[model samples]
Target: MRYGTRALLSKALLSLLLMAACGAQAHFQELIPSTDILTAETGNTLALSLKFTHPMEQGPVMSMAAPRRFGVMGPRGQEDLIDRLRPGGTDGKRTFQATYRAELPGDYIFFVEPAPYWEPAEGVMIVHYTKVIVDAFGAEQGWDQEIGLPVEIIPLVRPYGLWTGNLFRGIVKQDGKPVPFAAVEVEWRNDGSVTPPSDPYITQVVKTDANGVFSYAMPRSGWWGFAALLEGDTPLKSPDGDSVPVEAGALMWVQVRDMR
Candidate 1:
């Protein structure tokens, strides 16, 4: 081949490569539940849809999960509920959807990953969480702090029958009294030692109820450490009405046994 022709071909190939890279980056255009608030009822399915810039390639494995490193903080700056993403609908188009039931009411967050063709086409995607308010009718009552009631998770024994794992719950309190509308987080550590809880195992967060209670269930059968945190913009008021700062990383430990 001529020298000039060879040089032109190399440049053209490089340009094509760059264009392909850019296209892949744009695949994830936006998340459907983009708003900071999501309203749903207890036992009702919450659908989270992801809109891509282009139609996703067929056979690409897409999955979603809650944030492994962080937990949801309630309005009082305390961890409230257990949050998780259950697999939902998969339409071979510019969008993908995941459905999760709103077990309780309060704020929550989820981390989603869309990987097409087994390659790291996209990095970690975070979907800002919103409040899921459940009413007596089992329907979303919209966002209203006046009638807002915190939701709690109650463990129903391991579904598998024989598994040793940790159980976690979120607690919201105000003036030494539990906050019913506060969010709670309970994380399970895979390692038996509980000096501090780390990552990998399933974590759940839930909001407290009018009575102030939230719970989380772990899948694995073993010893684990747990942490509870309550977070919110509103400063917690003391008995004297003094505002207090809310922070993360409040932790504790619990022993889970396999009775099955």
Candidate 2:
């Protein structure tokens, strides 16, 4: 009887662990532009989409409240774009969209500071500081400039204009200092055409090196997002009014094209 009880207990524990693992899909804050490299042909106005979801899984997008902040830093200067955000959704889940017309030839770094998201499964609040770069008229300047997000991925690469299989690299920074050995998650924006064979195929995981640098090569064409997830220094209150840890994510979106 004792042995049978122990077996049942062990089985229950294993089942619980498996359940937790299954629920732990990587969450991504997507800040994607219509075209990374814009020209007269593509047009001057850039359409951007914002969403909280699992990119590779192409999710069940989590509901996103209006972000705390949204803007762009261009060659001239920073412009607040919060007022232009239009509430929208995909598959019934909340999302956002905005548009910006680039008049001059330079890099426009669009960024967002989202409100705290409470994750019941992890018992934590998540805040992703997300960014994407759009090059205007082939200027290609300022793609590497840091906007100083609370947690940010400073791209070592240009963040745009790349062929498939090009290696993208960046440094993970927290509070303006490099975060050595930070955990980074990489996912492709699946278009409902390709399905991952397994859970591992959904999100590829990588870690920063001793110098806080992480790199990943794109195996497919489309948008790729690199998210450096770190624990915030301070905890925030959950919806239940409990103090919970914060999962701070510094995310950057990049695009790669297949060479025709």
Candidate 3:
């Protein structure tokens, strides 16, 4: 084999790997509810959609496996609702859906611990601890409670009942401690009405302040997701039996409505 040929092949592999890493960074694990606020008109049975995808891009979705845990922290207590999840997807991409019946008129914080996803391109195992909140019967208690995820975003502001342009704040935590200077990626779940003029418009980036808190003022009225990723304390073994890095993300979802 010629040395020049080997060098060209190596450069090609590096380029391919960089492209894959950028693509994977755009992917987000989404856990959005049918409605952020539940009322009698909407009924007590709430439906939830769980998908791993680029919220802004919308179509380049990745398949998601059954989560390690899925449940809610209601006003009464934490309830394990994993059994309610059913297999689902779009265009053959795997996903999950579940229905939860709210018996109380209080805030229900729904959360999911996704199975670690292997990204050969990025060469890292990704796990997103995602959550969303639904206020039932106008009782807003328990929206601020943390579910103790490996990485979590504790909302500093009320996650629901917001109009477009309202500023949202949260603290990024890993292993129950503040992660100062954490990088957070924010995206608006596109409804096909908006087109990204360029790649940079698809996702927004923000960094936490000295106190591990980050703020973003949502300009559009729709579902918005924020993901703060950090390296896991321990590495995980890859399918090839080699040690690889683990990326843990603390994610939360919120909805904003146009002031009409």
The residue pairs found clashing in candidate 3 are none
Per-residue lDDT tens digits for candidate 2, residues 47-114, read 99999998888787999999999999998989899999999979898899999999999999999999
Error of model 1, residue 211, in angstroms = 1.8
How does model 2 score by TM-score? 0.91
Q: Where is model 2 poorest over a 10-residue stretch in terms of lDDT? A: 14-23
Off by over 4 Å in 2: 1-23
What clash count does candidate 3 reach? 0
lDDT per residue, candidate 3, 1-260, as tens digits?
Answer: 89999767754554454345444547688999999988989889888999998889887788987899999999879999999999987879999999988998999999999988888878778888999999999988899999998899999999999999999999999989999987788999999989999877887889999999999999999999998877776768888988777778899999999999
Clash counts per candidate, in order, are 26, 0, 0
* Deviation in Å, model 3, residue 254 alpha carbon: 0.2
lDDT tens per residue, model 1, 34-142: 2233344223455554432321222232343332322223333334223433334455433344554434554333322232121223221112222222122222222
Over the full model, what C-alpha lDDT does candidate 2 score relative to the true structure?
A: 0.87
Q: Could you estimate the TM-score for every candidate? A: 0.26, 0.91, 0.90
